[model samples]
Target chain A: AQSVTQPDIHITVSEGASLELRCNYSYGATPYLFWYVQSPGQGLQLLLKYFSGDTLVQGIKGFEAEFKRSQSSFNLRKPSVHWSDAAEYFCALGYQKVTFGIGTKLQVIP
Target chain B: DTAVSQTPKYLVTQMGNDKSIKCEQNLGHDTMYWYKQDSKKFLKIMFSYNNKELIINETVPNRFSPKSPDKAHLNLHINSLELGDSAVYFCASSPPGAGGTEAFFGQGTRLTVV
Candidate 1:
């Protein structure tokens, strides 16, 4: 079955430090991958997505993700973490019916 | 204006009560979906509608029914709600065509079943 996995359940990073969230997926074909962020009491917001062309796709809020077909990974990265970046991140895979990962909670330390 | 909006941002109800959550999207997208976020924060797709037609339905129980009146509206109604039903529900919409596109999400409705 196709699934997405975010190995880390919770991560803490100091402000101004770089951040990377890992995501791995299992699919038969080259699948559509996405990263989304959800803040407390707020709906999810799309961070970035990978479709066909470039392996590295940039998204809103200075977020970017690279889709690696070899490892079936689409990991999100940010150069510098902000205090406001504290939120839950989810990795999803699919075109129409998507499967979401368990999600990783990020806590930014001041 | 909100691209995708769900009514009743917060809902607290007793078990066995029937309740409905309404969703509307002004983005003119043809596909809409309902996703459930459990207490553990695991998000799961429940149902999807494309142009008022049901396209994807997960293993959700029969007690949960979804109705789409138009392309911009999708509603979820739960019957005989259980304590386990307490979770945050989100409504989202995407443009027509492939599913890989980014979806607009509503603020979400936090349902607490007591």
Candidate 2:
């Protein structure tokens, strides 16, 4: 079965520190991958996506993800973490009906 | 203007009661979907409609039925709701494509079954 996994359930980072969230996917073919962020009591927002070309894709809010075919991973990264970046991040895969991961909660400290 | 919108931002109802959640998208997308987010914050796709046609239906209970009156609107009706049904429901829409178009989400409706 095709599935997306975010190994880290919860991560804490200090403000202004670099952040990286790991994501691994299992699919038969080259699948469409995405990253979504959900703040507390709010709807989800698309962060970035990968489809065909250019393994590295840049998205809104200074977020970027690289699709590594060999590793079967599409990990999200940010140069410097912001206090407002603390939220729930979900890695998803699909075209019509997307399947989301269990999500990783990020806690930013001062 | 909101691209995708869902009515009843918060719903608190008693178990065994039937309720409906309505959704509409103005982005002129052909595909729309409904997803359920559990208390643990896990999201699962429930149903999907493409141009007013039922396309994808997950292994959800029969008590849950989705109606798409038109291409722009899709409504979900739950019969005899149970306590386990309490969770946040989100409505989303995306354009037709083979390259995986991005989805626009609504400000989910939080349903609490008491």
Candidate 3:
């Protein structure tokens, strides 16, 4: 079975601070990975995805994720997070139907 | 323009009643999908359609049937809805060939099966 795990249920960070979210998955070989962000009362927006080569994949809204083959992990990183960046982030793995994690809720404090 | 959209942002209904949720995408994508987000906020795939053809059907109950009149529309009809069916349903679309491209998602329909 293919599943994605987001270690943190929620995380709080001050505005203009660095942020990193951990995500691990169980798959056979290089599976397609994706990161999605969802705001309150809104639809999901794509953050980034990793298909093949180039472990470092950049996405919109100053978001980026790196695919680690050995660790079976695809963690999202942001040098500095803004208040608008506070939302639920989901890490997924698959092609046919995405298997999303429980999601990590991020809160930005002033 | 909206790429993907679903009807009735919120649905409140009684159990044992049958209902249907309509979904349409204007992105000109060949593949469409239905996902159920539980109370825990875990989104899971329920069914998928490509070019109006049923391709991927997850472990969903037979009561939950997806009807695709065309490639752009996929409606989910539930027969005798149960309380456990109360959750957020989202519609998404992809280009084709087994989800190689990014899928565009709709705003989601919050179905409350009482």
Candidate 3 global lDDT: 0.92
Residue runs of model 3 more than 4 Å from their true location after superposition: B97-99
* Residue A20 shift from truth in candidate 1, angstroms: 0.7
Residue-level lDDT tens digits of model 3 in A1-110: 79999999999999999999999999886789999999998889999988988999999999999898889999999999999999999998888778999999999999
DockQ of candidate 3, scored on C-alphas against the true complex (2 decimals): 0.71
lDDT of 2 at A75: 96
Q: TM-score of every model?
A: 0.98, 0.99, 0.97
- By summed lDDT, the worst window of 10 consecutive residues in model 2 chain A runs over A92-101
- Cα lDDT tens digits, model 1, B1-89, are 99999999999999999999999999999999999999999999999999999999999999999999999999999999999999999
Candidate 1, CAPRI quality class derived from DockQ: high
Q: Model 2: which residue pairs collide?
A: none
Scoring each candidate complex against the real one, what DockQ results?
0.81, 0.90, 0.71
Q: Which pairs clash in model 1?
A: A95-B99
lDDT of 1 by residue, A1-110 (tens): 79999999999999999999999999998899999999999999999888899999999999999999999999999999999999999999988888999999999999
Evaluated on CA atoms against the true complex, candidate 1 attains a DockQ of 0.81
What does candidate 1 score in Cα RMSD to the true structure?
0.9
Error of 2 at B78 (Å): 0.6
How badly does each model clash, as a count of residue pairs? 1, 0, 0
State the displacement of the C-alpha of residue A10, model 1, in Å, after optimal TM-score superposition.
0.5
Positional deviation of A3 in candidate 2, in angstroms? 0.3
